[model samples]
Target: MAGFLLILSLFIAPLGLSQEKVETIVNKLPERPWAVVEFVRGKVLFNGAKVLKGEKLRVDGSLEVSKRSFVKVKINGWDNTIVLGPRSAMELKLSAQKTGDISPAKYSLVKGACRWVRKKIEGQVEKGLGAVHTPNAAMGVRGTDFYLKVNPLLGETEIIVFDGEVEFTNELEVTDKKSLTSGQWGGVGGRYGQKIGEILNLSKAVLDKFGKKLNI
Candidate 1:
């Protein structure tokens, strides 16, 4: 009986962890398009510590694991955009288009999750300011319609082929590094091993959903 109980305990522990779902928007948010920062507690901090449009809420500091915090910020000038996941972080920078340059438009996603819809990105040296260099892989962000997902906890990164081609680099390979065409995906094993996962065909519905220019 003792040996049987030990085996069951191991299985039950993982199930308990998998069952816990991360909490969703806990605080009352202000009106849309305004800078809204939320805490783990049911309270929110509105426009510079002042309650402009949202309900008056005390700044709750419960932003650990039991709770989560996120901020929504937007700028008017730059035509660039970024999207993030839950409990994720990222930094954004944009370069204005020059007169005669091939791609004066450049965007850099330093960390976390971001979706970039580029106008014209065609060179490696033409990356906005600094490039996104993860622990194991490097991407020459040629202008394309795509997004990057890097898990902060797992230190794993996945580059999904949305549209256009992206040049990928790591450590081991037979020929030169490969570019991910549309509807394909690749994984980085953190040890210079490029594991090719899958290639998918675009059905009519899948094409309609991702092919059109939809708002983020």
Candidate 2:
């Protein structure tokens, strides 16, 4: 009986240690309202504090990327990644209506450019997934990879879609909206007046140019 009990303890000891290792990993993960900074280049700041790679950042404040700088973040509970380009400033007002649902995420791009890429979620339809609000325009995304450049001086927003679909609407005239798909481009405000610009094809050269800029 003593030898049998010793054998049983040997088998159970490793299992107990494995369980504790798993729990420690789970506890190290970032909680809600915080995101992981996956990449950073040049000077990046989150709410006035310098940002570093591999650190968890609270997304409740503003993010600024100085000239010749870039920052990439993965938000918790969201199936997407956001990259802010050089000279960009964005306010992260992100949330979900329900747990594990692709509810709308609200973010404002104050100036410069940003890129949003959504990973396909299994068994999830491509509609009403998220939204990005700029000064003059609002964009509704559906499992898409898109880029936005906000020209604050001219009050214009340029949107380019590389994959999936985006619904663009003028902030001043919500009735004026357009649906754009892959390889298409749209604009709001400035010369577009109270309506969104006519949807146009995105040339390969233009696509490559912006794609490289956003590091997509």
Candidate 3:
């Protein structure tokens, strides 16, 4: 009878813990944030180089990557940028836009920074998501390759286009997307995004890199 009681208590103890665990998780969901930011389905190494998949990121969720830990973002989506000191945080504000299939609202990834590569123009550009905000300016992208950087302490953003082009509008009129190609880049400071310029030549080195199957 003593042995039977021991076994029963063991099971009951775990069951009790499970309920408390569920309650804690449920309580966190609301005070935590409305949604989550799902990273690509791949392996991400932490400070010691370990590939991880299905990272559940909430607002202010952070994953620290040191020199020893390098991350490889695999798979598809509008996920083209990397975060600096990437708190691994999934900003609740952008969670919906990142999770939703389609929308007009834009999403911005601030801090650290990332460079982007655009896929063929097959989706809605306006409702599409693209933009990395930094302290000095913001980098806007549509169907092109661009880089963005943001420092947490400083309030600034900067952008550089490797291929294609971006629209730059600020204190003065900058280049339009219609004038970018290979070996060309641009930078902007201040509240940027919304729209960028275009590359006039489509049959150039930059566009060729994408290897799109022309309907012709």
Candidate 4:
């Protein structure tokens, strides 16, 4: 009975965390947070401070997660969410147009892994403006769900597109772009990137992991 109770407590602890569903807006440059940390675990840091649940993320700031930690945030003014994986460092830049609707999200993943999710815009499809920059390549995403990981030792960027498509391009060549559809994944490094093959289908275990991390 004691062992069972301990296991149940471990699973139930995270359920008690506050998951805020509200949106945050930034009217101008250097304004309030463009997003807020919806959930956090272990040692997550935002702009040098220890990140707390519900902490606002500044557009000009950066985030770092220690080993065994993760942080999820909801982007304001845009339909997207970002999950920073353990041992990762990321910087966020969000620009807003005069109409108050922000431009597509931009992120720089300096180290480690992260997941990106973009909700469908009002009428846009097939094309997206969100971009993520890694050491080896850049990714242009439409309304899609994707995962990216930067190998610190190999200097390679791994990408997996769960929904929609992502345009992967080598940072050295702006014209080089490869589109990866749902269930497709590949790697980018040394000035080139290629799609390996489609995954056919994602297992329930994989879906559950992403769903829990991003809260899609």
Candidate 5:
């Protein structure tokens, strides 16, 4: 019996040591910020308080841009950037998966317009960098530069892809989706059973107008 007990103790010792090593490694892991504010123009509020340049933003944070104001934020580690246009409100959320890996930066646009530009890193995959959810639609990024606008009152969302591609789907019906590429535009309406509109070529005039609005 004493020999059996000694054997059991020996077997348990490595398990405890392994657990301690794991805890030590986890504790030593560095904490990373979710995003950082790179620029601010006019009046901008983060979580109901005024925002300042170089501020670090965490998950579950909110941003509101007053009329004629703009704010620019860069996702830490990912190098992706988001710019909010006037009268825009957006919320940031983290994915359950680990950051800088399979996890994609998630955002919910409550209203107004915003632009997203994904920085292309050499040898990095172009997709799964970020996603945006609007009232009427959802967009999956593929290393793209795009502009999105939401009209809360009308329950509508407009999307224009300047470069790369965006996978757009109707929030109401996931099956109703389309891939928008450069020079393409689409939209979704919030009415009952509303679906994503047909993909259309964006005229240069429309691009100019949107560029002015987004200040891209």
Candidate 6:
């Protein structure tokens, strides 16, 4: 009887330790932030508190931008940046294991517009991964520059791909998928099921203006 109890205790101890080990890894992930605020203009709030220029943001945290305000965040360990427009709120999910790894982040856009700019790394393609989730659509990032806007009052979501490509899918059903390449713009969440529209050439002035705002 005593021998059997000892054997059982040994087995149970290892199992308990392994379970705690797994939990430790998962808990540490929530503490990691995928991006940090590099520049902030006007009024910006992080987790309902005022955000400093160097504050790190984690997942599930609320980011709010007031009128005439904008925030620029630099993605950790990657040559990419994201800018949030005025009168916008979003829930962030940014975490990564290390630099150059597949770090998938998503911003749940509750309202207003945001832009992502991926600087080209010489001889390297696909350095980072991210997505923008609206009320009705999920926009996938594919190593490119793009903009997403969501109007909660009007129930509209718009996307513009300035460089590379972006794939959009119906958030609820996940069945409808549409791809848009450079110089393309489209909208989702309306009375009709809209798809990607014709490509419109983006002028240099427009690109230059966005570039200047991206204080990366």
Sort order, TM-score high to low: 5, 2, 6, 4, 1, 3
Q: Give one digit per residue, the lDDT tens place, for model 6 in 9-113.
A: 566666665545554544444333467898999999988899899987755588899999999988776677879988989888665343333456777889998
Clash pairs (backbone) in predicted model 1:
121-143
Runs in model 6 deviating more than 4 A are: 1-33, 95-103, 125-128, 191-216
List the global CA lDDT of all models.
0.42, 0.79, 0.40, 0.70, 0.80, 0.73
The clash count of every prediction, one per candidate, is: 1, 0, 30, 0, 0, 1
Write model 4 residue lDDT over 86-139, tens digit each, in one string.
899998776533222335556889989888988887766443445788876788
Which structure among the candidates has the greatest lDDT? 5
RMSD of each: 20.6, 9.4, 11.8, 14.8, 7.6, 7.5
In TM-score terms, which candidate is top?
5
Score candidate 4 by TM-score against the native: 0.69
Error of 1 at 18 (Å): 69
Residues 51-130 of candidate 2 have per-residue lDDT tens digits of 99998865468899999899998776666788999999998765545323333457889999999888778896665645
The model with the greater TM-score, 1 or 6, is 6
Q: What is the lDDT of residue 207 in candidate 1?
A: 51
Weakest 10 consecutive residues, lDDT, candidate 2? 95-104
lDDT for model 5: 0.80
Which ranges in model 2 have alpha carbons more than 4 Å from their true place? 1-33, 95-104, 126-129
Stretch of 10 with least lDDT, candidate 1: 22-31
lDDT tens digits, residues 101-206, model 1?
A: 2223222333455444444534444343224444445556555555565654555566665766666655334243557777655656443234433434556666
Residue pairs with clashing backbones, model 6: 34-94
- After the best TM-score superposition of candidate 3, give how far the Cα of residue 143 lies from its true spot, in angstroms: 1.4
